[model samples]
Target: MKRIFLIAALICSSIIVLQSCSPKTTSGAPAVKRSGVTGNWVLNNITFDGIPDIAVKSFLGESSYKCFIGSTWSLTNSGNGSYSLPSSATCAAKTQTIFWSVNAADGTFQFKKLYQGDKAKNVTEGYRLMLAAADDVNMTIKSPIEYGNKTAYIIMNFSKAAK
Candidate 1:
């Protein structure tokens, strides 16, 4: 009985480990094709909390215009797990480096922007963009930001252009 229980436990743990370490597939092999992310992706919803006051102040005045930002994110996959955002429609500020990464094995996408501030040297933060479905044209990304009294979220939705 003891040996049997031990074997069962081992098997369970091994399965867990394998699943955790397994290579992630975004949309399987086809998803990572040479021209991946060509289709349109809308920002359906965004959820984030624990944002600093400083960040919130940046978007306060233009609350109405906030929605206008990030309208489109055109992704052009260079190769491997790397890609580029040829143009980001709604970003008002100027920046130097923009980085994009994807977990082809897992189907996870991330975009980062590096900025230099007065107090800090260089701060880089971005969100993880998740696809809705294989055929779904909507995608959601979440990021936290501070609102009026407390922290709140700024969720936006984006729709893909029809071919």
Candidate 2:
């Protein structure tokens, strides 16, 4: 079982998940969205496709995906980052440390939970989200879940928040 939100210090660079989004720049060079992954981000909303809202009990093994709305995420260049869950009427306030990275060519974003004294290399189980889009101010990641012989997606929408 794994928790969520681990990337390192915000040094100004991040993941580039743009396999099909490799638009050529003015100079005809491939544009990478690496810079879009770093910095402070807020999970503004979550949308589900082909899955009932009541079907899921938790997201990332932490809490209900509904509870994740408004969560703040920080992904650093060093592969260390954290997400803060603000206390709500139904959700408790929590901050989780994580180690995260992306397979840019494949448009995959993955992260592992970091418990005290736990090494990332030793933890094999992690959560993966498909990067639908990641620009300077917004990012969309999709978590695919298998349900009743069908694949459903949990779409997370995030917007950048300046430090």
Candidate 3:
């Protein structure tokens, strides 16, 4: 009787352990949905206060615009990524390599300028872009900039790059 009881207890303990160690599953349910920003994208347009920005139009019209080829903005599932500007961009829109993140709670996209090989240095304090909309293939972002005495919305649109 003692031997039988000990064996039964051991088997029960083993079964409990095995069940706890098993991988969890959702029983054929789909995985968590990823954010739409997790891919390479190209700048499509820029608008300032509901009007097309001439500087952006001129920048796109320049011959050096070809240099923007292969330049990409990449976001991650974990809300962090890198943004690389085209090398040949104009002085005012010069190349910038920065780290970016999305704040889902506030619907804001935050950017931090990485400097001197340090990810924590030269951060842009309080500079955040409001995400207007984002689908699998497109995203629109808006930021307020002081234009003269009033604030103007700088809207940027991006299209996802082909795989």
Candidate number with greatest TM-score: 2
TM-score of each: 0.38, 0.78, 0.57
- Ten contiguous residues minimizing lDDT sum, candidate 3: 55-64
Residue range 1-163, candidate 1, lDDT tens digits: 9999999999999999999999975534334421344454544333345553335434313333244354445454541122122233444442233345666554555555544442222435555544323334554433334466774654445566555
Better of 2 and 3 by TM-score: 2
lDDT of all predictions, in order shown? 0.46, 0.83, 0.62
Arrange candidates, best TM-score first. Answer: 2, 3, 1
CA displacement after TM-score superposition, residue 153 of candidate 2 (Å): 0.4
Comparing 1 and 3 on TM-score, the stronger one: 3
Q: Highest lDDT: which candidate?
A: 2
- Please provide, for model 2 over 1-163, each residue's C-alpha lDDT reduced to its tens digit, 9 standing for 90 to 100: 1222233322222434444457753532223355669889999999999998899889997768877899999999878998999899888999989999877766778899999998888989889878888888889899999988999999999999976
- In lDDT terms, how accurate is model 1? 0.46
Candidate 1 has its poorest 10 consecutive residues by lDDT at 79-88
Q: Which prediction has more favorable lDDT, 1 or 2? A: 2
Task: Identify the runs in model 1 with alpha carbons over 4 angstroms from their true place.
Answer: 1-38, 42-55, 59-70, 79-98, 103-108, 113-135, 146-152
